[model samples]
Target: MKLLILLLAPLFVVLPIYGYQSENLIDFKIKDQFDKVHEKSDFSDKIVVIVGSDREGSKYNDLWVKAILDSLEKNNTGKHVSFIGVADLSAVPFFMRGIVQGFFPSDTTKRILMDWDGEFAETYKFKEEHCNIAIFGKNEKFVSKYPVQKFENKIFEQILNDLRKLFSK
Candidate 1:
């Protein structure tokens, strides 16, 4: 019994023990595909919509990313919110970074963050196969989170509804 307990102790220490912690965003920084730096300070006065996927092969993740961005664009909430799409590109070779960047247009309104180290995933305690969203309210504090299980029109409506409430507050 003592041997089993000792063996399991390491698992407890290394595994993610809790859900997303809001305090982690207080001093976070991430670089976008264009190599522009974005930090907590840049989003201080606005609601930041972070859509992220830690897994490199989840098709649903890609679909959700596009759906979220398109919905945000259609809603025209640019004045009050910032959109960040984080993709785990850590497995790509350093030399291929330029090629990966080329896939995106030079002037996209959406800020696509290249999470080359998967730091944001660890920080947010995000699941590898799902699209996770974190909304930071004004003053750079965490507001709410949405775990996207599937792509549907209802999810978009829910997001817009939440935004309206947040903006009203």
Candidate 2:
């Protein structure tokens, strides 16, 4: 029994991490700030960048969302890519949601997706108290995720390099 338990314990730890690594993005559907529905297929054949906070109070909104938007807009990647901002709106009171939604930037360059119930964040296993960014490759598989304490030029460089590699493949 001890031998069997020892063998199974490793499986318990490895399985969940394997599952998270193998999960694809096809199961999600999100709405843009303009209320347009975008499915995972919309990102097919393109590298996808998802930037947002999984937290309740929109923590680090300025650092994560704004900096990513600025970086993407300024960089000339020329590679096919889609930038989506995810905001968990379930934290706000219902009455003020409309007002809060209106405050999302109306930039034509990128689209912000509203996650009302935090389902998207939950699905991606994002930390609930900090901002993070996820990169999905052209194959629609999750590549990597980064938790941001701050955004700087180096982060932008890494993102662009990843996009280039994805574009090449």
Candidate 3:
């Protein structure tokens, strides 16, 4: 019995470390580029789509956004979806935050949450140097995560299909 317990102990430790576990979005209160506070409760009853990227991954965020918007439009589910942009700007120094913020468009109505301390990305386990897309159901339950290093048709189709299914539900 002791030998068996020892063998299973490693499995128990490793499973929690690397195994897949269902996670729900935590109740987070963060500010957007416009300094508007957003919380998980604000998006309740709507399918939330989170597009996150680090400095190196910023280039791919636009492509992912376009695809997500297109999918929502195609399904006619725009009203049911809440899009949230999260920029992982943890690496930017305090003094440089203003300079980085200046780079973002000033006229856009869309709000992009600035993750100054990387808390959001760390919680979601967002991939570095890749466009990380996470879809949550209306209940705020995590549906899926797609970390795209390069854009591809298949990947786009998969995202489209996922959105379609979620909307259908």
Candidate 4:
């Protein structure tokens, strides 16, 4: 019984983000590195891309975030996609965001922010999950969510395809 209880314990964990609702996705006040405000609704009628990342100082995050951003750039849709760094929202280690940034090119299209406490992560349910990409419609409705690593000829490709679908509607 002890072993069984231990195994089952992990199952009860609750994800930070309950789920995305299209209606609740708009009129946003998300922070930018410039200490400016980005209205979630500005992307209204456009697709909103939100990435929840943990500030782990590893080459893995760099590769993943870069790949994710690169795919967004190729998206034919004119929607705005943002990649929020874990450090910006929470108290992620200083070095971790830098490491992820290093992997990316200077002119990358995706906008990245430091998520220090990961309010965005939990709001988007990124920490308890992997590849927690959420697509909100122009009307601020939740459309779709996909894992970063699963499909796409590559992980990033899959993300782009999802974006196309998001903006196509």
- True lDDT of residue 165, candidate 4: 70
**Cα RMSDs, all models:** 4.4, 4.5, 3.1, 7.5
Name the candidate that leads on TM-score.
Answer: 3
User: TM-score, each model?
Assistant: 0.69, 0.68, 0.83, 0.54
Give, for candidate 3, the lowest lDDT window spanning 10 residues.
14-23
Per-residue lDDT of model 2, residues 1-169, tens digit only: 9999998999999876634433566466878778888787877887887776754534565666566556566765544677767887767787886888788778855567888876666667666666667888877888877666655678667766776677668
Model 2 root-mean-square deviation: 4.5
Task: Give the alpha-carbon lDDT of every model.
Answer: 0.71, 0.70, 0.83, 0.53
Candidate 3 whole-model C-alpha lDDT, 0 to 1 = 0.83
Error of 4 at 7 (Å): 26
Clashing pairs in 2: none
Query: What is the lDDT, from 0 to 100, of the residue 126 in candidate 2?
Result: 68
Model 3 vs. true fold: TM: 0.83
lDDT of 1 by residue, 1-169 (tens): 9999999998887666553465635475778867888776876778877787755434565676666567667877657887677887767789998887777557757567888877766677666667887777776666666777676788777877777777788
List ranges where model 4 is wrong by over 4 Å: 1-23, 57-75, 78-88, 92-111, 128-131, 149-158
Full ranking by TM-score: 3, 1, 2, 4
Q: Cα RMSD for candidate 1?
A: 4.4
| TM-score: model 2 vs. ground truth | 0.68
**Residue 141 lDDT in candidate 4:** 68
